[model samples]
Target: MATMSSICAPMISVLPRRPMIVAAFQQYCSRRTFRRTLQVRSCSSATSHVAPLRRLANYHPNIWTDEHVQSLTSTSKVQREEERERINVLKEQTRNLIREKQQVAEQLQLIDHLQQLGVAYHFKDEIADVLSRLHASLDHVRWELKDDLHATALLFRLLRAKGFSVSQDLFETFRDEKGNFEARCENPIRGLLSLYEASYYEKEGESVLKEAMDFATEQLKALMEEGSVPEAGGLREQVAHALQIPLNWRLERVHHRWFIEACSGDNTIDPLLLEFAKHDFNLVQDMYKSELKELSKWWSELGLSEKLPFFRDRLFENYLWAVGFTYEPDNWRCRLNETKAICFITLIDDIYDVYGTLDELQIFTDVVNRWDLTAMDKLPEYMRLCFFALFNFVHDEGYRVMKEKGLDIVPDLKRTWGDLWTADFEEAKWFHHDQTPKLEEYLENAWVSISGPTILVNAYCMGKDLTGEALKSFPSYYQITRFSSRLFRLIDDMGTSTDELERGDVAKCIQCYMHEKGVSEEVARSEIRELIKKHWRALNASLSWDSPFQEYFKNIVVNVPRTAYFFYQDGDGYGKPDGETKSQIISIVFEPIQI
Candidate 1:
């Protein structure tokens, strides 16, 4: 007990400052009362030590030092005020950034409105003046100031729409410091050009469009070599280059007759075959010339003469598709005339039986059956050696492939010749005029009746295991037809034969399905996007197919999968209506595997 009293003596004993100390203790107790409400573990831990003190002191509240409390309160107020000022500064900065963005958005909306007005009222002199001013203002904007390349490209397009050629000027002005401008604009100008070129080259000769292609290619290469540009933009260069050159150009350049003519030696005329060659060349040339005349007529019929330049390319593409295989029965004269002496009659039957007029068909058939290769001089201006060369190529190649497969081909050839002649002669009564179908209807029929199914089948054969039932059921003739059809169809679709829709006509099957499901275009488009992505995923997930045919399929499917943005028009023309948003619907067709 004595030892315990000694231990407590320091804590309890009175001293000179005993009253002051006691007052301090009472004040500390009052502070503890307020702090105890906090429920801190430390407060609970200290409660045990304070129990005896409460019993002993029973102290009254004592005033705290004015100096200490005033100093602490003033210091806290200063700190809080400083914090508030800091918050206000941050908020002001955010507000400024938002204002900047909104201003930019407003500017974009204004630009779009101005463009719509320009296109709608282009012919009106007053509106033209307004459009001109807008163009001047927009043209004055430095390319480096554009935060988005897509936006800049669109602006350039708008300027072009306002009747100014911005292609060369756009490159000169906006070649540097684009920042995210490239990201935003997406190089829409180049894209438009590429699509246009790709669509155009399908029908027209490459040489005819080479100048324009070179210009576009140069612009694309500049974007790529700029190095500072994003890889995304740079990646488009190859596509631009590819679109510039159609497969026909590559094929024909290396092996086709047009290329052979261009590269022919010394322009030396072969006396024996010169007239024949010139005659055949003229026939082929005349055919193309006739196609161009037909195109002009088609344009006039549609009242699309003003839009002709826009479709001038696609029209040429249609020509390419039409004429690609049309005159294959004859080609440019070759040096080895003897080796090229095979008869030309592969496509004559198809033209007479399927595509030609009765009178024209009769003329063709009679020429085929009765005409003599030895009597080249007696033939018309169109039936000379050039035609002979092309004919020889078809017959010779056909004979070789057939003979290698162990078939008696001579009698088959003679029978085909007779069939062509018979059809051509008999159809003369029906050859009143060339049949012309509605452009869209003709293309749709072509897709369903020939190209679409054929290409799809080709894609299947390239990927699927073609053993057992598939191998047996698929005939040699069907295989040949399907293969030739795909090649022709691809060429045709690529803008050579016909102008296939850019985004692909989903056919009623797809549109009806979407409508029946009661889904909005937005939802349907989303689903399509997901479906396409899923297809690509599955395609990538599979073992990489390495064969030549597989590679070909991959190229078509991955690189040039058909879409139909070109020929489709709603109530509004090609694009969206005023202040209305539109989404694209993409449907993918796949073959189901059988168990």
Candidate 2:
């Protein structure tokens, strides 16, 4: 929304408000609770059995059935060769969509469309060439800054999203002498939408971009509710969608499929681009189907859902999480590997949190920490199958990572698993003892319990060259991953805490805040939301670290949290995908655009 052109000696003078208290409060909590918490934690480490475990039915049985597995495994879906050839032709046509001499605004809009279509990866060089030239000669660009709010905002959002250092000065052109945005203009609603999208890339301390967000959100929300125009209904839908998830937060494939439908019936949209988008989308869907065929077959063979009735059967959701981790076709192995890893994490988490009793949990934890099948005798009959499943999976993964990749990250991977178990065990201990930790105290361990770092370690190992240096140099990656884990914990707490509390879990961050500050649920939730944003900035800042690995490698870590936010933003979208997330999964992975 904002761009740089010239300096504003005293540009919009910003009124300074009270500094945010959340960050300060978090630091204060951490400091104040440090010594006492350690003392409490020391006592907590010594276990004392209090009461017999209740047969808790806190969660419902998983909806999956053997028949469901049978049907998924039996399905033989394949895209015909004819479709591949057709898509190749359409890709060529789409390539022609980005030519050398297009107007700068048009080029930016085209790039934006291609990106949202999930086919931008196919045209990276073409898009990059256009943006590079445009960036080098912005002054000589053909588009005038005065008349085109939509184009300006779109260009700003796209370029800034691509890591360009565009400034906020150009946005000032839309403001009056009193430094207020002009809300009345041609296509003001669409302009405001793009401006809102652009504001997400605001770096820390950029008050202008922050102000732009408040301005655009205020304008868009008012416009949506007022029903001011003949096409107010369409405007309402567009506004609602934009305000619900900022463009940066959206998964590319998910947004792409949605856009394919949104652009339908719009005469101005390029026919070639639209056709190519459909072809590419379904083509990728075919790839996902093919991959899932193998994964589903493997999952069906495990018979996990039938054996471990308590564990949620989410074969599809696990794979979907991997897709979020890395969606490029060449990264299928990483996706598959990460999918299996997360599957175990999810099930094991369920075991510690819900199903397994205190004695059973300690035995299983020790068995897992040792990765020893000999200890399986100590587990309950049901847990033996679960333990063996993970044992065999880890051994197989270890062999692949070592023999296939010629690097021994097995130990590191197991260490991540160890960290996860320690965290999970700690929480299980607190839960069993009916302990309510201080906000800082719970957060210290809860982030790990979220298991993002463990899942991401598998992702990193799968996707990267497993060098000795890379294996040992994991702390930096783990640091970035901690940010993700914290976000996932916060989001999970936001979505599932009430149910969790009812089921006799330890106090989540929100509950701890409510207890500590004596605040209402609403206020506690608002504070948690602010804290989530704080970690979001931390995640963004982590990407700027001097990493031994490439930026893409780091991005996979960052995307861990991005995908979590996408998954858990509204509710426990991953665990309960009945509403927005369900539709999104259908659009991205199953339904094809009707070309």
TM-score leader: 2
Cand. 2 TM to true fold: 0.83
In order, what is each prediction's RMSD in angstroms? 41.2, 9.1
| Residue range 228-306, candidate 1, lDDT tens digits | 3333432343344445443212322112232223223312222222222323333334333433444435433433213
Question: What's model 1's overall lDDT?
Answer: 0.31
Superposed by TM-score, candidate 1 places the C-alpha of residue 443 at a distance from the truth, in angstroms, of 6.1
| Model 2 error, position 169 (Å) | 4.8
Q: How accurate is candidate 2 locally (lDDT)?
A: 0.69
The TM-scores of all predictions, comma-separated, are 0.23, 0.83
- The residue-by-residue lDDT of candidate 2 on 1-595, one tens digit each, is 0110011011222123223356533443343354235335444553553433333434544444445534432113354476778888988877876875377667777888788767787876787678767767765552465566777787777666555556776577777898888744467777788788887766666677778989999887777678652353345555687889887666656667777777665554677788878877777777787777778788878888777777667777777778877777777888888888888898888888776666677887778778888878897788899878877887788898778768876776776787777678777776655455667777777877888767777777776555677666666565667777788788788987766655545568986776567666779999999888778656655555333344446657756766776777776776676667667666666666677
The runs of at least 3 residues in candidate 2 whose Cα sits more than 4 Å from the true structure, single-residue gaps closed, are: 1-54, 64-79, 132-147, 164-170, 183-186, 229-236, 464-474, 544-551, 578-584
State in Å the error of residue 303, model 2.
Answer: 2.6
Runs in model 1 deviating more than 4 A are 1-360, 366-406, 409-434, 438-595
